[model samples]
Target chain A: MSVETRTDVPPGTAAPAEARRMLRTLARGTATPDRLRRVGAVLVVGCVVFALVSLFDGLARSGDVRDAGQRIAVVRADAAELYRSLADSDAMATSGYVAGGIEPADVRARYDADIASAADRIVHAAGLLPADDPAAEHIKTISQQLPVYNGLIETARVYNRQGLPLGQSYLDSGSKLMRSTILPAVDKLRMLENEALSRAYGEGIAFPFIVLVLGIAVLAGLVDVTLREQRRTNRTLNLGLAGAAVAMVLALLWWSVALLVGAAQISQASTHRTAATALDDARIQVLQARSNESLVLVARGGGSADSEFTKLLEKVLGPNDNGGLLADAQQAGVQVESIRSAAIGWREAHRKVREADDNGNFPEAVKLAVGPDPTGSGATFERLDAALGLALDTQRKAFDDNAGAASAALAGLMAGPTVLALIAAGAVIGGVARRVGEYR
Target chain B: MNTVNARRPFVYLCIAGVLALGSAVITGLTPPPAPPSTATQEAPPPAPAAGCEQQKVDSLRPEGPLPPPGQMPPGSTMDTILKRDRLIAGVDQGKYRLGFRNPTNGELEGSDIDVVKMIAQAIFGDPNKVQYVVLNIADRAQAAADGRVDVVVNSFTVTCERQKLVEFSTAYVAAAQKILVPTASGVTDVKQLAGQRVCTSRGSTTEVVLRKPEYNLDVVTYPNLPDCVLDLQRGRVAAVSSDDIILAGLAAQDPQTRVVGGALDEARYAVGMNKSQPDLVRFVNAVLEKGRDDGSLLASNQKWMGQQLQVVPRPAEAAYRD
Candidate 1:
């Protein structure tokens, strides 16, 4: 120590080796200012690294939540809307076929709107999905098959107007195509979009473990170094090191609180997503039941249309009409009572439709099934569908609000880590420089 | 200081773990939807072999001229129908020119429909009093047995087997099974189209005849005659075989097709009634007696099918089982 160990480097020695020797010399001294300065330098470098890592990671996470809230949710809804419109279009077409004189203007207009909306949604949804996503293939299949289905419906309409039974045949083939091809594709696309939305949610709130670890380690190092210096100098506190420790503590605390809140919001949003899909599924079943009912009359009770109605009815109301899809939807926190009651009423009306047909009162059956009776199967099903639509809207709004809050909670998280870490680095340098200057 | 706040991070982590676990548990409560089944049901096994030997069976006889409209005999089926004020007639709406609903006006008009109107006119005095119920060809006998309809005028063919479940009136119209083909195909004979796909209405006598191994042809059956015509038009089948009248109506709608081939089997079209309702059968026969004598049934056949088919319709002469 008296010889001033490693204070001067030997001539021709490399700078790095000289520096290493100096660090070793500083380590050998107990309660020395040089060692305190070395510890402070390490803490400053740790703070710099932590700052860079958290800054980029925080920004990326914020972006993920924004994309999930805005982009993924929209695409998911578009896929759902596409499925509904296609099914509704077929129902309208079948209804028009049964009403058969000249096509009813309202039915025809509704069909046209459904087709137009379906096409529009397909285009919009395709644009939003990533080019390499598996969802793209399903979108392609639906777009290709839709026009073919429409052509068949048009041909059927012409024949129906002319009172040709072949028109019904054409209509049957069209519906077959829709069920076999287009609907299945839309179903797949919807599933894929939902998966993407969930992935975004998971990524948005994932913990930044490395940054927090580095932050805690730097704070501990600074505190340990400052305490030794205080004891060595017989002083109570070092202002510079104390300031750096405080900055580290505040940044870590803010990050933890913000992420926790954001995670809660994102999780709630996911719940809404679950509820919405349930409602969407119930709505689809309603449309299909309507289609099957009308086609039975249009085909004049041929084929398996009657049995198909039974199967579809069971799908919604369960085997006994007490619980099924509506029950499942209820478990998802959606209000299904309205849909359930309307469905029960619709079931009763459908029973009368079948009875009249069985009793050889075909005109009476037609009147009960499709006539302007306010309590008929058609009107009751319409009410059920409306209720489902309303429930879906509520869930959608809930999802949007929660998702937006999730994004908002991430505020300042990106800048906080970087700014606080820079402040810590400055304090560490200032505190160590003061001691080293006194020794000089 | 190290011990004082060291457990704070652990506490926060515990809270976070609990929250995440709760969410996962909640999500797991909903079982994911099962994938839709892709399998289609197989068609029902071919109908049971004819239960009885085939034979020509004359329908019930007309005991007297039909009671005057609005003056039905007490305790008769007609009287009950008059009390209800509407004759519920089960008919096929798909058989064009026979019992089809006219799309232009939504009115049921055809030869078979004409028979129903006559019966209603006889009982209720107003032809408009009849309420039409469109039935599948397979349901005609069961509908009668159950008393679900007052009468069936769906171009029904009489056979000994049907007599077990239903009673029939004197034939108001006569028909024979024939094959229809696209005019462009130039295939005139059923034998020439052997080994080719042939279409017919499901459960019809023609379906039975086409499946006979000797024909050596593939057969496809739809719910109605027009459906077969569509298959033929789409080239999915080489020909459609059905009653000549129904085939004639289909050919009339699409001029590119024509009815050909000889009559494979002949059947008499009569008003089908419940076996228990012998009085109803007699009443329907009385009404048919008027149509045959007055040539009104022939006039209807001519008016509905004359342009489509050149052959003049021959109504069966009145015969009596009792």
Candidate 2:
């Protein structure tokens, strides 16, 4: 038996030069015991390590997404609360003042409570916020300017009680401060939080394709080596290599399925949660509109009602039916259709009041404005506000349900894969070592 | 010894794992407490005592119709005023169209100050002969108590509490409390202002009603009426509550506001005098009687408040308390 191998080819054999060179390379191929074992070890270890890295990287990013989503939800809620508080305080302040010169006890208490809540929420938001976040500046502005506005209001109160002509001007200044500075700052903070939330969701479902490629490569290598070993030894199977190959395929399948589930969850969250959040913006606009309505009456034709209030109403309800914030919310499938109609009605009532005032029916205008009549602007505004609030609640619930599920789906996934990866690596080493022992 | 050494790595690994788990659990169970914040708020000042009642009193019995100007009753307060060469009268310069100085021209012209001029005319026969002393709401009572001015006629609202502090002449002008709000303000009555900011002048009867627990209003008081009107115009306070006539003056100044709702309280304006000066009180009452009877009161009302008020001229009926 002359060791029928290419490396042992006779020197006189009439072989082409290319054929000889190819045979020499084949003789030095990885089929040799040491090379096969070494190559198999590398493939198995490489696959496990690559999968582990990909798993951990994906896991870290998913964790970040989950944390950011939760934080964004909290911060966004606080921001909205602050915005509502400021707006409600403004409306209540105006209503109270219109009702009387000195604020009624109930109205004053409500205003004070609103201010306190706004301050507290700002503090909480500031704490959760990044050091360099733009929202931090807005929060600072609210904090700093809130006290100033309150002081202006108190000054107005004192002056109003004294029956001084200057008190009305002070009250106007206070309202201006709220509209121009504080509310806008709060809106900016809300927008920033919203952006951060979207970024986190985008990062969470980012797929890691490298792990799949590495897994496939490792499996192919194991299959090829096993088939080669079977042919050379005339054996039907190598149990150890078969085991390693099976483990690699299983890991690949698990990673692929897990990624698909995560992606599906992320997609659902993006569509539903983001849309719901957009509705929140519209809901806030409704609140702002309500405040403006009250202040319009408070202004007593001081120009704010005609200019600023008109602009705000158009912004909230969409001008000429061409899609404002509420329209956008409707297109997004948020439950704001009724609110939209109510807002229109409120605006119409307001216009009627203005016309009455212009026509010199001052008493009639006042009655239309704040009267308890079902068709009055006050009642219509309350309805519109309530409808929008309900819509916001519904959207918030959907966001919490969907995003929360997505985030929860990722929990324990990281830890499970980490432990599995270590076991897989150990198995690859053990299985390959068993095969190498056959040569001994 | 070899067996024991072989198990050492496993034992050490187990120990490390347990320690790690134990420490994590311990740390998780005991979080660091948050630091206390240093922010605090100052306590508000205590509120003033309440329960002052609005009171009505009878006019003193005048000797008769007033004598001609410059011919005063000898050994009386009128003689003392004649000797002084000018009627020393206390007036408010801040009241709009009532006692306020005109910003356009340096002249004191208003309903209350007009009454002061009438008194001066009665004493020295010249309306410009009055030496004017400006008095605030608080100063009105003290001025009368200390005899700083001949009489305080600056929208003085009579109350049982203030009567204890200073004597008042017979009620000259009976003003009533009412609400003044912007045209757009839906508040039509004081009852509607239950939770509203209701501004009134300090030491005014409107303040008493606004501060009552039943009304539950945010009663903001200022030293003078102009400050309250300023607050209303600025949208700082909701509505102003004071004497209807005073509010009408405010409404007249600013077309944006109107006096709405009925009277919350009655304010009977009287000339404030020293408790010891009964003759002065009687003499001022006589002047008021002449003014009320001779249409001068109606004339002053027409001059300053006619456009703003629903004027129905009538004499203030005289009553004798003694």
Candidate 3:
């Protein structure tokens, strides 16, 4: 085997290796600043491009957060307006009912004003909302049904004045329409708005972990490349490139930290505090309005108004204390204690009114319902309404404060990132240009 | 060889780094699809209570043969009441004189209250045994049909539509549709109230008559006749329209207001029962006939109303024979 084996090598391979070695030796012999500067320029430009891209992306993300927050704030405002309009409408119904035959002029005017305001708010909300949004759909459904409900009320009023038994039927029908259709739609709208708000809050306050990581990575890469270049080439420092790298890293750190702080503030204001309180207060107001309506029916009789009211109240207010029918009695008591007391006073007034009715006292019941002394159910209802209004105002203020905080926290956030990123790009370009000049 | 040495490691590292970065970016950018949200469950259907359907059927039955004057058949309403050991009747709990609740006692007592008691006496022979179910005007007919109550005596006006659903006994009380206007209003009649707002309780015959173009009143309907009265007082409406009996009740309740218009239409009051219960209907008719003939009805009416009522006169032949 040793005799037959032969080591075959290409004739030019050794010669080529020798030539490459000679070239390497010669290059080392003439190791000059020009070739080193060319290599440094190439590396510097590549790093600068990567850093600039990362900075731009981070800036864009901040813009997205700010935009999301604004959208949520707008929707929240719309939800508030919707709630107010519905509450005002409920008040009007009571006022009109107590005023006898026709609602008082002022009451009617107030009713009209509420309706108009609600319509206007719906229009504005619709414009702001995407057509495909669920909230928009709810708004549309409410808008369509509101007119029908109003028409039914008008018809009921007409029949009632004619002394027709059907008047009661019409009025009952109208009230049913409101309960079944309009109110539920309002609830849906509120829910949808809340959803939008939550989504915005989430987007606005998203953790900046990704941007932070990228910033640290780029900074590390710059430091490593600089140290390597300095050690290998025996250079003291590449001042222009070092300055650009430092400027870019500092800008990234500053922008990222500021954004993180803003995001945290927004999360606290919008997600944790304002939204939850507003929703709770809104729900309470809805329950109170429903309870007031039920009490009216109880007085009417032949309507199972009391029983129905109880059932609905149970559904809305939840189970009562000591397992009684009025479980939420305490909450209701707190919210409308004055109204409850007024209800007691009204009952006394009603007793006298009933006696008068027995003595042929139609006028007496009418007088009791509309008495100016603030002792009637109507007056008590007004007091309860006032209380509810105060609660609503408090909730609204909380919402505004939180929403404003969330919005304000994001202020200058977008512009700051964009401007810093631009400055970073300028530094990177300047650093690369200085290296290129050394190559020249 | 030098070029290959320089390019090979860089190309491999670049590929590996790009793949890792690509995967990370894709994972971050595309969120997982959300799980299907549970929808809010709808409220469970209301319990299938016994009365609603039964009441509808009873309210639809055609009138059968009239009972012999003042004499009920065997196993009639009176006999059934004795058998069941309970008397159930529908009444109102809102009408002041007709039927109103006494908050002090949480008991319903009024003229209509007395009438139901009389029927109870006629049936179970004890008025106290009568179980009164308060119903609105809309539910009264259905309540009768559902057999939830043996009779509906909720100031129900007899009408053709109601007759189609339930068997009505002979009219025990006569009433007419009338307008209740504020004393200050110049409007006196339905004709004079054309284009003027008049309020009435819902589901009452008053709504139907007043809204008719012939009456031409700007009719307003309310959930209760009381609401209509309130509207009239507030001047939201010019008058309140409803059955004259209700109007009379209203007037009696308020001396400041009165039924200003003559009856717009003749309305007869009858006790309603399910059409399926012909024997019971016959018995009720017999009790009513006897009560009228014996002046018990007259006395009860006078006691509660503090005045005379135009009781439906018996047929001329029956009066002559008697």
Candidate 4:
């Protein structure tokens, strides 16, 4: 009846005694309506802020994931266009040779289109990336150098048109520029984009742990407060406050568990499976395409044909040696071994074609390899394509799975936090009102 | 309670602000330095002085006070032939009569081939002591600069700028730049080819001449004259233009092609040596002078090149100075 009598017994109290008295008073419910309302407001505000921050963080991470995906797409497109340009150039050269000097209009058109498309994609990619990024810098360098290379090609074309001896020089200079500068830059850009993608994946999946811990802590604190209030009040519940607490706890639990599961699934699908596999496949595809094209050029018959082709073939298919193309491919750690092996078979087939060509047996080599019957470089290209396709498929699946999980884990999480926080506010307010009513 | 409680939020704000400021300072003040392995080092000091030596041959005193035989510059034609056991001189592997590669052995053999061999003979006293270094049209200058070859004698036309980097003996072959076109193309001169594509090999003086505003022809460049001819036959270009001798060789190979223009510019081919090696230049000039006087030059020209053009004239009397 007189819990207030402790006021006189507390003078000169020991520290533990003081703490115990304070605890007992708290247990006895000195909480007034206004104080309860104030405390509830603070708790509600804090939870809401926390929830909003988590939502923002998740959204930011989602942005990173999206950006990474887009960048990869751009890179893939650019690489494809570059490959098309190189192939078209080779085709033009062959056609021109066969025609004795005149490149077919269609071949020229194809070459032009490929160059234009590659340039457009490079420009678009540059726009997409920040100026400071290495990929952007590389794109800029390529863009600047393209005109110089084109100038040389134009000079060659003009000379060829005029039946002049200098056309070969122009073609040679242009080819050298492409080999030494543009291609290397593209390679570097691809590597940079891959790095960016990895960073994005990390950002996308990083917040789950922090959110889980915070959610659990807040839920536990609310529950403890509710039970203590009930025990002191000698009531089954402060109905309003109890309802709010229950809602908040449920929402928190749901969000935490749902997000954890979703995040795990996304990590498994996107980071662990899809992106990794896709990147590997893409790299291999690039290598195969490049090697195939180089082989075609090196094999084009002339003085030093055998030696040049042999050197290039060895570079493409041989074991790792410092500064060798094959060594670089290995360092890239793509599926290069199988690709190289396939290249070796292609090279053998190409040699047969060359022999046939040299022996004035064009139809035989063309029929045996590039023919519709499927036997030569054409078949090898198809095989390489299939391998790349498989790799791409595997990585794409992985990406989708991880992204889906990440996105799903965050599903309904934003709403859950807000609702729970409001409920907690309601419970504290209601508990204080009940106490106030009883006193009155 | 109202005033004190209001002050509490402000205190929290201040604390948060301080923490943020501290974090910013820490992050902003320090950045890790790039590792040494990642840093690009200065390109190794351009090969030692042995790679570059002073010209010892006095052009003014062509016959006086010349270095004794076999005492040429360290990296001269003679020194290189002896050291590498092969002559590494630029020779045309495309020009059939001048210097074309023998398809069977891939060895270059022709008039120009004989010239390089003569240089080798002069150096090692053995005409067979030569290693032929094949160079594309664009690479001749670079090959010489990078020390890839001892000299560039691939019918190289001497130029003033080229003289700064490499020394030249007395002009051995005289030719002129000309335009080669299809006999059916009706192009007879540079004037007729205005606005039309004229092809020339890169790094050749022909390109420099064609690209000049005076020529006003759309200059197309190829790695070699053969490619230009190929391009011309394909109608990818309107004409193939290069030195008259090269054009003549192209014309000879393919009956459909012919040199259409008179000499666009006279080019005197000379033996190129590293500019720093004057002693070697003197040795080469001495041999050339001897060949000129003894009629061996004429005999070799007739034997290898199939024609006697003109022997280089000897230096005439001039006012002597101290």
Candidate 5:
């Protein structure tokens, strides 16, 4: 049984001849015990291979989860913050313009804050992206054009102080550049970051196909050896065989549990990420509406700015108040009930501002648009912004926590399987070696 | 961070605007370029047509005494506007001295705004009861024709081409198209600007004159001449061509730029109305007649345009062709 195949070594190979000599000496024993050593060798190799595959697979999944949680999340945050701050700066600048040459101190401070935040986000986003990443180019473009936009805005302010209409023209130029160039760049960067995030997420919780197959093979091989031992010795219990079988079952069970828990956590993180994205989009729309609202008065009803303001508001709140980005966010499980109401308030205030301006109540329009009043468009928009900001923060925290737990689910997954596999291999060797010694 | 100097954005905006408007003014404290040469505007022949009996400066005659405020004649345009509560006047907010919105108070000020008020006062007796619709140079006639506004008064020049679209009022202010050039350009006359790029507001009469093959000038039109001033400062064009009043506003904004050359063509500033509203035209003309008689029109002009234009003359006498 040990020498089941014909001796087929090449004629002039000393290594093969030496291997054969050793094989004949080992094969001189009875068939049953010689076969036990052969079966054990095959089982040990199977267990060791399964352990190696599990270790590598576990490490890969853990690495992907970590990357998603830290590096990808930070870059994604930078992209989203860039968008928020840029839109905020435009809205504040236009709204503050309605306050006239010498803006209110608080309005000025808010505008300054928006600009600083935008600049900071740009620097952070640029630093985070790899040099060769496509998003880096968009960041570069945004950084370069940001100053040009600021220069134009400053020129507009100067013109406004001097009571010149050229100030509005310069302001329009600045706004145009922001709309056409800088904002779009941020959009592209965000899109790229989102793709990277999705990729990391997919890898972090992917099914362990190769590891599972190897694990199953090891279990079946161990079962075959146990059956053979039982038949040869007429004893159902071989403690060594029983121990190896327990270790094999435990390894597979732990692997299954870790994979299931990690996948569940990743799915939860994805849901929160989706809801947060909707809130981000809705917030940007609100900021854009606020910008156009004041700019209509700034341009004094020229161009399509007034209509644009209306359209932006409608997109955020929906034309019939039944569906829009806010509604969509609500459907996605975000708490946008407060945002919707605040947006409606802002819309009402914006309507009054337009009415007052159109009806030649210029001072009243400016007051309503950029208010010290509690119910003005400015204040209403602020409330809505704060609400959206809070919602976004909650969603981000949920995503981060779930992602952290996903990586933690994979903790010890690699070492536990490898250690169990090593123990299983030792038991197989010991069990078969004792059987072979009895035959000798 | 931008790592900018300690200067605040407000100061930066002011400096940048000053540089753009008068790039050389702050650099060397260069004296403001010489005030534009005063030349009386020349009126061109009306656009020829097969059988049109329209005149550039002719309008309906004022009939009887003025209608009292809030008690306009029934079935009249003034009555329609009165019912609407606020008089809608189409004016440009970018015309600095004529109809600009004051950045200080967000109030629409300037001489053209005063004209709108004059009409508002006639209808409502409250000069502030006006809904200002900011129209571009191209939209002026369309605004009146479509009844989007009861009157258009943003330095609106009378022309036979526009006559086909909307009714006109007697000339309230006389202006002319002129050349505006950079001080350092050393180019003064319209002839010198021939073959060089010049900017005019889109749908402005200056575009027509500058586009003439004989002038051989490259004409570029913008939404407003004040916008053209941006182009001029950036050296995008050799000069800007528009009504003297508009050029004056641009010049005031940017002292480094100066209005030059004699009047290229004449323009008569008048209120525009829906062609179907002859009564409205007559009513507005009567208001202008009163302003001219009381010297208030000239007074408002002096207040707004006197500094930029260097001379504020009395408005022309009314002409009726009804």
Candidate 6:
């Protein structure tokens, strides 16, 4: 009655102006029942969306974390065992051949066991990986070649027992096949597994930015609604709006705590597990290289054998001009200087053995090549491998401790987020519905 | 009354559902991981040429009586050997009993080694003064041609191509190329081995014969005879074919294996010397003649080959070209 009439100077426009003023009033009063209900519906839906998004995100990330942890602990361990078994088999075969007369029964048994272990590991590891995985192809190659290598070794053994020098050639063929084909494939499989692990680990700790922004936006909108209510109704607080704001804030806080804890754990695991794997790789390479060296002498391939062992040694340790696995370990924070020094000693001892053999002092050469004397090249190689073994043990322990903690930290995180998300969504719906009720 | 309009909220719910579904698909349908480096399998090396069928191997005839020990004629290769106080003979240390070192004694003792020692004794009267230089099957002739050794006695098969490079002594042992197979491989002869892999030493007569157009057999060549035996054991090859003497040695080693097929070619074993060393060739021929007259040659063959070979004392009849 008042505002439109107070404008009393315009009599003919009174009807239209009154209508206009009513429209303005309706527009200004956002607490009207229809508008309140609409706003409450939107807020409730927003909370539901946010809850679902956060829950699924947490669950997916936790899955990645769990997968990576399991692979590092189990799959990588199987691969490492395969590597060791192949190298050990090669060494035993060479030593048995070099034993001269009849191969000792224990040495023969050990060779067979090592071969069996390698085959078992290949089959087990292949079963775990998908068909399309690159490691699977490598596994198939090793599986196919293993029997051929074993057959060659058996032939060498038979010929050796017969005192035929052709046995050495057979042994050479077996060793060459192992060094050039099967072991390299295993090495490649191990590398692919490590790469997969790192990828999964990387994905596990990524932050959920969209979830955080949406949560904050919802909280701001709730606060604005509460303040507007206070201004219009002279109320100190709207319990519904206040409850919604608290729920949004609590949801965000819980998300933050879980993310921070998971991030720390993943970070620790990544650092220690990657370093440990690198050290193990280096150790395995050293073992294979040492086997190559022994086999060259066992095969007595002469100049060609010498050069072949040199190439293999360079691949494992380093060339005199550059660095290889030892260099890689050093870069990864492992103390491998002792291993390097021991390898150098091995090379020197091998040179002396070569010199004796070339000088036609074959007995002296055999004594220097495989003798149990501390100064023999074989002894030096043993010392080198032992040092690498120690290094590997240290790294392995560190990896186990850190990765275990990482897995434990992610424990229950997936389900915890889902539960929190559900409670937050329920609370938001309830709070917004109460405001709609007040409007009614 | 306020209208209960649910259209806007419904639209928002639809958008949320679509976004959620999109993300799930995105996460679930990731492309497969790439394979690691693909290893290239090792390719086999090039094989030697297969000689023509008409090619004949002509060896020297070792005729004449050996002079008394240390009583060589003046200006002869034997005199040269006597002055040097050592006979450098190229030998094989990988052939089973034909030319292999004794494992227990670490001494080079084989039929070939025995023949060379007798020659050394005829010149110096001491077998210990001989120096053995190990040579492979293909390099034996080259070693003699290059004068890197005085003689190559490592199972040299007298062939036309080899005779062109070096002079051959009379064939000391007659070996025929034969097939060795697993006991129950269902392959009794070379005819049954068509389209199947047969292993032999590289650059040997057996590999050459197997590669001929008529056989159409797949031939796998190895660096040494033992490797062929290994391939046969693994069933990678259906059979291993080489000189009968070599097959006999291999069969003796593996009880499950036997010499199955008949002779494929006649491989004559002879010692090789450089073409420029005529006096040395003549002296070696003389030594062979004297060894055949005495019982020492038969003894040498028996001592190493008694188990696998019933070696007949049929010294190669000598014929001179000049």
Best by DockQ: 6
Give me the iRMSD of candidate 5, please.
30.6
Q: Model 3 residue B129 lDDT?
A: 64
Which candidate has the top score in TM-score?
5
Ranking by lDDT: 5, 1, 6, 2, 4, 3
How would you encode candidate 4's per-residue C-alpha lDDT over A84-104 as one tens digit per residue? 454445444433433334655
Every candidate's lDDT: 0.79, 0.70, 0.57, 0.59, 0.80, 0.72
**Model 3, residue B123: what's the lDDT?**
57
Top-lDDT structure, candidate number: 5
DockQ of each: 0.16, 0.03, 0.06, 0.05, 0.15, 0.19
**Local accuracy of candidate 6 as per-residue lDDT tens digits, B144-241:** 99877788888788888787789998777778888999998867888998898988878776778888878778888876787787677667999888
Model 2 in CAPRI terms: which quality? incorrect
Error of 3 at A212 (Å): 3.4
Off by over 4 Å in 5: A1-49, A232-248, A302-310, A318-323, A411-440, B1-55, B64-71, B187-198, B208-221, B234-239, B261-265, B310-318
TM-score of chain A of each: 0.88, 0.83, 0.70, 0.68, 0.88, 0.82
> What is candidate 1's CAPRI-style docking category based on DockQ?
incorrect
Q: Judge candidate 3 at residue A200 and give its lDDT.
A: 58
Runs with alpha carbons beyond 4 Å of true place in candidate 1: A1-64, A97-99, A131-134, A172-248, A267-398, A411-440, B1-52, B159-165, B168-172, B191-196, B264-268, B317-319
Give one clash count per candidate, in the order shown. 0, 45, 71, 47, 3, 2
- What TM-score do all the candidates reach, one by one? 0.76, 0.54, 0.57, 0.55, 0.82, 0.79
Residue pairs in clash, model 6 = B61-B318, B61-B319
Ten-residue segment with the worst summed lDDT in candidate 4 chain B? Answer: B313-322
Tens-digit per-residue lDDT, A302-396, candidate 2: 22245665777777777785578876766666766687788888888878877664443445665776667889876787787778777877767
Off by over 4 Å in 2: A1-33, A104-106, A130-134, A302-307, A320-322, B1-322
Q: What residue pairs clash in candidate 1, if any at all?
A: none
Model 1, A45-161: lDDT tens per residue?
777866876798788788888888888888889989998999999988887766657767888898999999999999998888788877888999999999989998998778777
Native contacts matched by each model = 0.19, 0.03, 0.03, 0.01, 0.35, 0.20
